[model samples]
Target: MRGNRVNPNKPSLYLPCETRNREFEAKLLLACHAAERGWRGVVGAKKAIDQRIARLPRGLYISKSITRRNRFILDIGKRLGHIVTAWDEEGLVFASPEIYRTTKVGATTLTIPEKLFAWGEANATAWRNHPAFNGTPISITGNPRADLLRPELRDYFADEARSLRRHHGDFILINTNFSLVNHFLPGKSLYRQMLQAKKQPISQYGSINGLALHKVKLFQHFIEMAQAVAQRFPWHKLIIRPHPSENLDTWRGIMAGHSNVAIIYSGNVAAWLLATRALIHNGCTTGVESFLLERPAIAYQPVVSEDYDSQLPNTLSLRVSDLNTLYMHIDNLLQGNTSGQETLLKKCHAHACQHIASFDGKSACERILDSLEPTKSLLLDRKKPPLVDQIIGWTAAESRRLFKRTQLVRRTTTDSTGYQQHIFPAVSQSQVETYLQRFSTLLNRFHDLQVDDLGDCIFALSKQ
Candidate 1:
């Protein structure tokens, strides 16, 4: 979608898509809102973030993947005189060692972003004090994605949630976070590596490789827990929502012959959270989301340790250490007996409010836009890209697309019965407008800005 009457000379707001489309939808919705405020906005494909920045007028560009590996994008944005901000999409709960690894943190510290917007105080504090981001500016702006599930926007997904309930019926959501077994390398090889890495004696625990091995073992335990739940609750409907990075075929195989379980992967968690009887996970951000949505969240950690059990979700969610405890809690929730968890819910609310940023739903996005407002007049006007440069960009994009297609074809040929990939669906113009209209107050408050549909994911630009 595009903006109407956006002056070519005016500064623009550029948001790049992520590998997962829902992640990018957060930025797309923000772009729409920005357009309504008389700010020029552009949503670029993930692969063409650099190309879009190079061709467009200098403005603010927000990207989720501004790691040291892709620091070249930071350099390009700098050379072009654009303000680039890197926000963490994964949040703080699952802090990857890569963030602190010398390869990633050391190289991009100075060039990445002038400021990094974190999920909350906890995340902001962690990133600020990290050896990698020692001197970087970090703000505790609640993630915009979480805003989609806030109370103010609860009605936004009401229809979708109702539809999901009608189709899937009342069910408990089992959100999985075992990407190592279900997403990354071949499951057999990955499992072998995990076993090998875990063979180190207890003294080696917490080491770089040990940390990963611990994670892999956790994934294995998570799957076993799921199996136990399925067996114990044969009458109840269980909806297993695998991580977007997961392979669904593995889940399908695990759930085979279990008519009581269904596997789903796409769509926002808010709808699913709203529809479910309870949200069950080990160490996932969905529990935080479920807490915000006023849903019962149970963190099942059958195999726990200090290094792994200390996640924010584990702290906020009701702790269920064994299959029996999980079943008891889930059964109580299904039977409408939540009086016992009052203290736990209160703690979750307090922690959420303190660390998850804005619960009102509007502040996070507004704060982001407010930060970029000052840059409107500071943009440097440059001549459009030469035809040769444009040609090269287009050629490069096409080549990457072809290469990905070839890889997909090869994978399908090699293992036709393997796990099928589910792509995140795109948000249509109608969907964007529907959600944008929910912010009527913001739209009316900024009547000078207007948005229009520009096909091909590029929009026209103008101010007033």
Candidate 2:
């Protein structure tokens, strides 16, 4: 549950959910884990932080996006004497080649939060070398999301997984990341937009890398290959799970009247991973996620290029060049064949260890909390700003809130520009209490922090 309307008096941890996917769950679990350890905080969507920033106290506010808007918010938070932290939800998925170079990337300047919690050593080293983060404080805390994927916590979603198995029965999950192609318009219009992007400056949205143009074709190939596989194995169920950012209607339209092929976009990926016999994808995060769950995955690359191939999960998964190859692997797995799988599995395990942080089924949140112990007194010693400073912070926070409400603020994604919006399912006060109560042993530590319910989309950690 969100913390009671930002109470400046009580110290709390603020975790903003950038997107409602596995990352959201991971962060939520962190908040719950925090509560267990006597920390009080609210987990809300990114917009929720801005809406209630005025009442927010001088404590830590955590975020995931690397956008300018978030950087602006952090700037404002600092002005009001609050600690801000950030981490990439997609940190391990893509390599920003520019981060390797001495010169800063031209796309956008890095927004170095007061504390930047990186996922692993590789990410930490990249940020450490970057010019913008010259003096920024950084900690290589393993991602909390990966903590949930640990085999021990599998019981948390066991009931949901059982329901999924009953509903989808021996299905093959095919995950797609064609959000760039299917989010807004169809192929021709989308291509035109891509051309327009190329003409524009190399901002975050418009890239010279040609990933969008290449992805458009890649999406088409995925669709064609999915259909081919479905046709060949009509007896078996093929579940096509589109990326959350993608347009579900487009996938539904493509697979209309196909009984064996079902396009589903509901439920968390973890449950689906458990329900499936095997997983298939091009180069999406789900491949790595499924790998963590001990599921076999095949990367279908009909048209491959050295420049375009994904290095992490894509390379790690068993690569199948065409539909025939994909069909062969899937058929073999379905029939319970694992004779020649040891070497590839070993490589995937090694890659995950090298790339991802701790996966020992323990709370990474604990490690993060230990890092904040030195600053815990700062949380306790929060002082009210001078009256004039309070007035200025309130005025600025309200102005930003109004600008966002009126759609006056511009938002941009990797390949598009618009007002980005997301809403998390609100948890009730009772629900929050019940969740915290489940981990009562941890809650016994913090005698000062308590949960406060601020009505109408706001909740917080408040001083008891």
Best by lDDT: 2
Residue 88 in candidate 2 has what lDDT?
69
Candidate 1 similarity to native, TM-score: 0.82
The residue pairs found clashing in candidate 2 are: 2-459, 3-459, 3-460, 4-454, 4-459, 4-460, 8-57, 36-442
**Per-residue lDDT of 143-258 in model 2, one digit per residue for the tens?**
88777677656655566789988977778889997765776234433543665566553564334345555676788898888888788888889999887666677888898867
Please list the residue runs of candidate 1 whose C-alpha ends up more than 4 Å from where it truly belongs after superposition. Answer: 1-6, 19-21, 48-51, 95-110, 184-206, 360-362, 380-423, 438-464
- Which prediction has the highest TM-score against the true structure? 2
The window of 10 residues in a row where model 2 has the poorest summed lDDT is: 99-108
Evaluate all candidate structures by whole-model CA lDDT and list the values in order.
0.64, 0.66
Models, CA RMSD each: 4.8, 4.6
What lDDT score is found at residue 46 in candidate 1?
Answer: 53
In candidate 1 the C-alpha lDDT for residue 193 amounts to 62
Quote the lDDT for 111 in model 2.
53
> What TM-score fits each model?
0.82, 0.83
The backbone clash count of each candidate, in order, is 6, 8
